[model samples]
Target: MKFTFRKYERINKQKEIDAVITGGRKFFENGLLVYILKTDRNYSRIAILVSSKVEKSAVIRNKFKRRIREIFRLNKYKIKTPVDIVVVATQISVRQKYKILEESFLKILNQNGILNL
Candidate 1:
């Protein structure tokens, strides 16, 4: 899979984010929270959120966002259905390792039947 995160693949609009949060089904594993809403597009779009409540430092928050985005980018192909996915990081995620985060993310995807593998 190409490991590029493109602009079209990102859910950046506030209205879109709100729709996903309000209309999507939710899944939680470890410190990772996921909201998924089916869309008409052929490919999935994603948003990663690292709240200030999770970490006070901007660097820490960005790190979490990057890690989650990387995980999603790498596993994007596993999702057969077209959907909008929003990933929210918790305070515990600030200190967690990338592997832990990846595992938790995959677990939630599997639970939601979004991951083909």
Candidate 2:
């Protein structure tokens, strides 16, 4: 089955912030990183952040977002908890392959105890 993260689940509301800030954590790995805040709900959400400082063009930024989303879609099962994940891209990410980026992200999630495997 194909699993997806929708926009409405994103941590945009004040209530979401309170849930995260009171009990959230972060993780980092080569070429990828994540900030995860567990939620009491039963779903996951994602926000892919690519700053213009890394890629000035909107096209490039969107490309980065797409790559991040695709990676998350393929590996969402690794995460066993309901959480909000924010992925912020760096300059090095633009030069890395998708596999490397996905691996790095998974590593971080695993380290943070967010991933079951």
TM-score for each candidate, following the candidate numbering: 0.95, 0.79
For model 1, residues 1-64, the per-residue Cα lDDT tens digits are 6779888999999999999999999988887788999999999999988878778999988888
How many clashes in each candidate?
Answer: 0, 0
What's the C-alpha lDDT at position 116 in model 1? Answer: 95
On lDDT, the leading prediction is 1
| Worst 10-residue lDDT window, candidate 2 | 14-23
Model 2, residue 112: distance off in Å is 1.4
Name the best candidate (by TM-score).
Answer: 1
How far residue 61's Cα lies from its native spot in candidate 2, in Å, is: 1.3
Evaluated at residue 113, the lDDT of candidate 2 is 80
Clashes counted in candidate 1 amount to 0
